[model samples]
Target: MGRAFVYVILGGGVAAGYAALEFTRKGVSPGELCIISEEPVAPYERPALSKGFLLPESPARLPSFHTCVGANEERLTPKWYKEHGIELVLGTRVKSVDVRRKKLLTATGETISYKILLIATGARALKLEEFGVDGSEAENVCYLRDLADANGLVNVMQSCSSGNAVVIGGGYIGMECAASLAINKINVTLVFPEVHCMARLFTPKIASYYEEYYQSKGVKFVKGTVLTSFEFDSSGKVMAVNLRDGSQLPADLVVVGIGIRPNTSLFEGQLTLEKGGIKVNGKMQTSNDSVYAVGDVAAFPVKLFGETRRLEHVDSARKSAKHAVAAIMEPKKSGEFDYLPFFYSRVFGLSWQFYGDNVGEAVHFGDYSSGTFGAYWISKGHLVGSFLEGGTKEEYEAIAKATSLKPPVEDLAELGQQGLNFALTISKKPQPALPIEVSRSTSGLVLEKPVYAWHAAAGLVLTASIAGFAYWYGRRRRRW
Candidate 1:
């Protein structure tokens, strides 16, 4: 037997969850939509895997960190999906996708057909095997990507509490996990080849602020080197990690976050690829009209930068998914997916938010010694990006708005001197359409945007509330 649906979302992650919520919000009919995911549970916030999920106390779990909920929206639990008549084929992977036939063949020997398709396959974490290292499958070795990976990591962390843990990678995953492990009382030694952590996004000065804080917590940094091999015990557990610098860090557990590869294998040759991901238009629609891609798999135009980028972050995933749905539902009035990239992370007691691109010259501002400080990236004589640490919702919004405006940077020295004052005054000159603010709790751990700071989580809330959707042609024609 086969199942037919008006809309089928392939892959259930953050994007799938948010898309399902949007569908329900726009008045979807029962049995009209289905989400096929490899995970047994419905979509949850994937970031928690590296942050709250590994905490020593009140570790985040299912339903608690569900998608949309983080945005202060209704959490889409499996029960909720059932109530909405949305099918969830969890624990089933799509073996192949026939875009022309509008059918997806599952590894379970099931064929599902859809009048319209949305691909939210997301991405897979890079493995140690790919980096010439072995024993990633060891019991103590962990990689955080989804619920299962997080659960496995928590289990390993618990068993190896107060033990030495080696974390590979210096990006978001590395920093956040390193903090979590330290809080859990595990000795953390972070290894990355970058001169400092978060090299791609953070300036040397900004990176120093975080590095100092991490150092205070006894987190060691092994920079400018990569993991070469792993020493495993007879039980197939990684006991230590050998690095390229001819050094070895003893490890009771390993948390790897080198990078991720977009899960676009199924769509190879079936869709146009760009920037290492499936290329899509502003609508997030791929080469095929009936098919759309979102999350880490779709490289769409970034109107803010006048270029295309494949952003592997939760904000892009949620926004792109919702945008694609809106476009499919109402092509004429859905509007273009003009999104400002927002990324944030909470490690220990420090939280930071970044908006726009990190290209061009950077200007440091605020007191670096204190908790509150930031920087702005100027590209082609425009403030194209902003980074803020320990900022109020209003302050964060100021920089985000100012940067997105591509505000002219007349003098670098003057801009540096003014610092936050420049961003604070930017909106008053030329108001950003639908301005947003970034906010969080005083603890500096709760990443919250009180109002329109539609950067990431809060933006998810604002966007969902007013996605400006109309009626899907296929659904309207079928149900009406």
Candidate 2:
């Protein structure tokens, strides 16, 4: 006989933690929910691995930077789970899942049955060996994906005498780890095939600004090229990296941040897949009604883009998980998941955030030479995307709100000059002529004067009671 659960979350990542927290808040019976994870710990702040965890001094550890805390909510420590009567099956790997049987078979031969399963398997780091290199298997080569990886890197950093590292890929992992390595007194060399760091998000001009800053910090950038192979010593440790540009770099340590591939192989043929992930409806439900997917493994509808995307960011994971749990708990009241893509990274004292699709012509704004600056991407004459560095809280909010409206930019040159001012102005009111085409139903302005439930309240109520409800409801779920 197999153990049973009303809700089972697979994979212990941000999505799983958020989902668990939501389930408890939304009300769940004791013993009805369980979370199975390969990692010993519960869901954590995954982004910290490359940031606080790598800091040479007093790095972040467990219980402090856990999930829910990132969202300013209560942190879900192990005791919290136990108090909520939510069983946690940690450090256990599920070898296979039978959607038809609604059963998950563990590697240890334990069969767990679930009435509803939320697959939050997340993703795995792309290994260098996949690109025809043997360096990934060599000692001193680290990949940042989980707590273990971060801990191993920390240990290697402390033990290394050469104080030199070669970082592969110029994406998030590479940029962040390089900063940490530099802080640890390691001479770092970044190798990537892109023309600039963060090529996917930053334009050459923007990239150059950060690259120059990195150069000042003793960080070396080897762009427009890739690692061909690794030079290994007799001890099977990576000694140097061979590049396609006919160059070699002596490395005491190697960190590969090439990319990641979603962990969807387990459900490849069992479930419908799209956009490199398990296809899920607006409710995050898979083809099998009983099975749903969230986080990186889910190819969910991006309401802003009008397409399905497997967003590999912590914000998306948190939002999608909560929305999925809501749909399950209150199917009647739950609507389609409406989300805007958000991505940000902080490295070497520089922080930047981006909202919406980065398409069409990018108009550089502000002073790119130093300090605060950004760019606005005008696609189809609409201000579809916004980026900012060293922005105030209000400024960041302005860009996010303005970008969400998809305001029209009639003159690219004028918009560029206006920059953050234009976004701030448009976010406050409807700019009909300036590409603001928000549906009347979704506007926050609609509820500003009302005091009832914005989504469900009909007609206006007459007092403090209604106003308080509206304020509380709106504030509690402003982002959702």
Candidate 3:
């Protein structure tokens, strides 16, 4: 048998949830939209899987961390979808897709047709087996990705209480999971081939601060080494991990988070691919006019950086999904999507936020010992990126605004001396307001002129006219 929908969203992820919300907001009728996902439950914030969900006490659960809530919007729970009359085809995988026919063949021998489609398959976490090291199937060897993975990790954590735990990789998952394991009273030994953790983003100087903090928390670091093999016990549980440096560490539990690969295998020949992801336009539309892509699987153009990038962060997924929906529903009103890259993390009592591209000369500021420090990246005499820790809400906003504006820097020394003040001053300056547009009615009467003004101090926009004035607040774009 076959089913049909006016719009269909593939891959139940952050993008899919946000797309569903946007579609409903744009006045989608009941039964007109459907979301097909291999996940058994509705979409929840994926970032939470690495952070709050792993807490030792009262960990975050479903419905609490569902979609839209991450953006401070209404939470889209399973009930919410039902109330909206939106169908959620959970635990169902699309075996094949026919873009020309706008049909999807489910794994269970069902054909689903749609007029328009959104692809948000996201990515899958890389396993140690891919690196040629076996024992990934061991009961205690865990890799966090979905709800099932998180639940498995939690069970392993509980079973290995106060035991030695080995965390592989130095990326977001490794660092966050290590912190969680340490908090759970487990001896955490984080091993990675890089000289330091978060090698892709944090510089040596920035990494030093976190390394010191983690050390103080009893988390050991084994840098410049890779796992060559795993030693398992009679019960098929990982007991130790052998490293490339000719070293072996006792491991009652193993958590691997090397990296992720975009889920683009399904559309390899059917769609244009770039940067290891499906190619899409500013509107998130793929090469096929009726199909679109978003999340980690879509390599859309980055206007600020002037290049196509496949961002594997949740913020891009959410914004791109909403933009795609807007473009589909209100093609005449929707403009090109403009996004500023953002990333953040929280471990123990520490939290930090990074905005814009990280390139060019780096300037360090603040005191590291006191737990307040930040850095600015200057490229071509303009501030291109800003990173801050232990910053106030307004200070974070100032840095984000300055990074987006790309304020000119005359001297590196002066910029360092000025520190956060520079961003604050730049943020204080007023932005050019959009010119008021006026139109005439068919009766030759002048219609009310609409004034579009930016409120810099509040980071909001005011749309005023003879009829009324409405304030539109901007949301902070953040990724895990």
In order of listing, the candidates' clash counts read 5, 3, 0
Expressed as tens digits, the lDDT of each residue in 297-363 for candidate 2 is 9999876666678888999999999999999888898999988889998988989999988888999
TM-scores, in order shown?
0.89, 0.89, 0.90
Find the 10 residues in a row with the least total lDDT in model 2: 441-450
Instruction: Give, for candidate 1, the lowest lDDT window spanning 10 residues.
Output: 441-450
Residue-wise C-alpha lDDT for candidate 3, range 1-480, written one tens digit per residue: 999999999999999999999999999999999999999999999989888898988999988999989999999999999999999999999999999989999999999999999999999988877888888888899999899999999999999899999999988999999999998999999999998899988889999899999999999999998999988888888898999999999999999999999998888899999999999998889999899998989999876576788988888899999999999999989987778888889899999999887888899998888888899998767788999999999999999998887777889998888889999999999865655444544432222343644443233323243224222222222321
Q: What residue runs in model 2 are displaced by over 4 Å at the alpha carbon?
A: 430-480
Give the lowest summed-lDDT range of ten residues in model 3.
Answer: 471-480
Give RMSD (Å) of candidate 2 vs. truth: 9.1
lDDT for each residue of candidate 1 in 1-480, tens digit (9 for 90 to 100):
678999999988899999999888777899999999999898888887888888888888887888888677998888899999999999998899999999999888889999999999999999989977888878889998988888898889889988999999999889899999999999999999999999989888888888989999999998999999988888888888898999999999999999999999998998999999999999999999999999999999887766788998999999999899889887898987889999998888888899998877888888876788888888767788899999988998898888766777879889888988899998668543664543333422112222544456776776766654433555677898
Per-candidate RMSD vs. true structure?
10.7, 9.1, 11.2
Decreasing TM-score order of the candidates: 3, 2, 1
Query: Model 1 segments beyond 4 Å from truth?
Result: 430-480
Candidate 3, superposed: residue stretches over 4 Å from native: 433-480
